[model samples]
Target: MTEKNVLIKSWADPITGACPVAEILRTLGGKHGPRILHCLTEGELHFLELTRAIDGISRKVLTDQLKEFEEQGLILRSPKNDARQRVGYSLTAKGDALCGVFGQLYDWSQYYR
Candidate 1:
């Protein structure tokens, strides 16, 4: 099969429901998902720090988003070690790999615009 056909076939499967690409898009398609993941690419950050980094995201939304990412194995939540009781979050290898995809999408957007 050709590369194009392989891609098309991968779009859906009975077992997985969605391919890796579609799964990724569905996960990061949210308003805050991409931003939160992007922020973590720099380094691990606490809950409050992520809120501060991503402006306009409410505490509720941020909390929910972080939980989803954790469940998906995209980000790691560290234990509270400081006096402030902050929880650090960092991207896993799987999550870090997606950063390139995001960058490519950004570049593609710029090219079109």
Candidate 2:
């Protein structure tokens, strides 16, 4: 099989193809996803707070990433109880599980770099 076909086949597998770890990595592999997750590590925040916390991210990109993360069950979105009832975002149990992993990865990278 060609290299492209091999890549597609691996990702398409029903058994190992739908690897949770791989999915998490793929989701968090890019610049925006990880940053969004990191921002939520503190606590729940509204859309504007997230936008302010993560520097250099465009609103459109943040909105897209937030939607993707929510769909993946890595984050939870709820309506705020205040007057405006704005939507807020926070890490889900699955997302919280990555807290240690992020710390360890950061430490490891620090050692290497």
Candidate 3:
């Protein structure tokens, strides 16, 4: 085996076993995920508002992304009414913290952009 491969495996084995960074990236690295979180950072939004705010995202894609974000505890989904079944999405504490990181990243990128 190459020395680099051996070094990488040695460094990665223990750390990669419980890597939250990998999981976070997996959740937020998607095309819609960052945008979804960014919108939610503003305030709670209904399904239609989300689709409208994020141009070019289809309903199906938004639905899938919302479901995944909810499952990951990055966002909250609650029915707006008992009878109407309208749902609103908001960022959780964890989601807010992640978005703070996104804000920092955005500010940093402004230097180059």
Ranking by lDDT: 3, 1, 2
Cα displacement (Å) at residue 78, model 1: 0.4
TM-score of each: 0.83, 0.78, 0.80
Model 3 segments more than 4 A misplaced: 1-16
Which segments of candidate 2 are over 4 A away from where they belong?
Answer: 1-14
Could you tell me the TM-score of candidate 2?
0.78
lDDT of 3 by residue, 13-104 (tens): 37556666676888777788999999999899999899999999999999999999999999999888758688999999999998999999
C-alpha RMSD of candidate 1: 3.0
lDDT string, candidate 2, 7-72, tens digits: 663445576556666767888877978888988999999999998888899999998899989998
TM-score of decoy 3: 0.80
Model 1: ten consecutive residues of lowest lDDT: 5-14
Better of 2 and 3 by lDDT: 3
TM-score-sorted candidate list, best first: 1, 3, 2
What C-alpha lDDT, on a 0 to 100 scale, does residue 27 get in candidate 2?
Answer: 80
